[model samples]
Target: MTDKKMNFEVSKYDSEIAYLSFPAHPGKGKKGIVMKQKELSSLIEGYKGPEVYLDFDENGELIGMEILL
Candidate 1:
């Protein structure tokens, strides 16, 4: 493996929602831009936090994350 750095964008809206987006893979055209609470259980085992959500592309690569603040 080669040493590489990945760039991400973080945005907070109205001090309510914090979004972390991956610039390289936008995850557009995916079923759901943000995974639902029910979906989170299967993806992240033992994670019981309701404030975090994730976005994945068709290829199952994590592309974004949404956190409620």
Candidate 2:
């Protein structure tokens, strides 16, 4: 994925996740997931600086999410 600010639901919330456009239907919308306030803060805190973007790859094993600085 590109380093664009995509939407994702934190797994901690209600045990459900929604992606923008979503995996079920790729490129179907302008924005897939809508981030909640807490999730947005957590993501921002990981940056520890100015707001930017992050990108990651799909690990062959388990699904992975990171707050990498």
Candidate 3:
């Protein structure tokens, strides 16, 4: 399921998408970027939150995002 989870643009290779928890600064939003699907899981590893989420388009563009907490 392509749920809502903030991701980042680390790198890419083939069908793998390297994503991270929308790298956010102190009291600020995250630096979102387009990422592949394969990278999504590893990026979200070892994180605590109310819930995980993501926002993107079929064309691989960051449209919107959110965090359960």
Give the candidate number with the greatest lDDT: 1
How does candidate 3 fare on TM-score? Answer: 0.33
The C-alpha lDDT values of all candidates are 0.56, 0.34, 0.41
Q: Write the per-residue lDDT of candidate 3 for residues 1-69, one digit (tens) a residue.
A: 454455454333422433344323112243534342332334677755444345554556545344333
TM-score: model 2 vs. ground truth: 0.18
- Identify the candidate with maximal TM-score: 1
Tell me the lDDT of model 2 at 42.
52
- Compose the digit string of candidate 2's lDDT tens values, residues 1-69: 644344455445544433332232223333523232123345555545432222222332212232312
Candidate 1 C-alpha lDDT tens digits along 1-69: 424334444453356666566663444355655433324656677867656766666566677666664
Error of 1 at 7 (Å): 6.6
Residue pairs in candidate 2 whose N, alpha carbon or C atoms collide under 3 angstroms: 20-32, 20-33, 21-32
As a TM-score, model 1 comes out at 0.48
Please list the Cα RMSD from the true structure of every candidate, rounded to 1 decimal place: 5.0, 11.5, 13.5
Model 1 Cα RMSD, 1 decimal? 5.0
Which candidate order results from sorting by TM-score in descending order?
Answer: 1, 3, 2
Runs in model 3 with CA error above 4 Å? Answer: 1-42
Question: Which portions of model 1 show Cα errors greater than 4 Å?
Answer: 1-13, 27-50
In model 1, state the lDDT of residue 40: 61
Candidate 1 global lDDT? 0.56
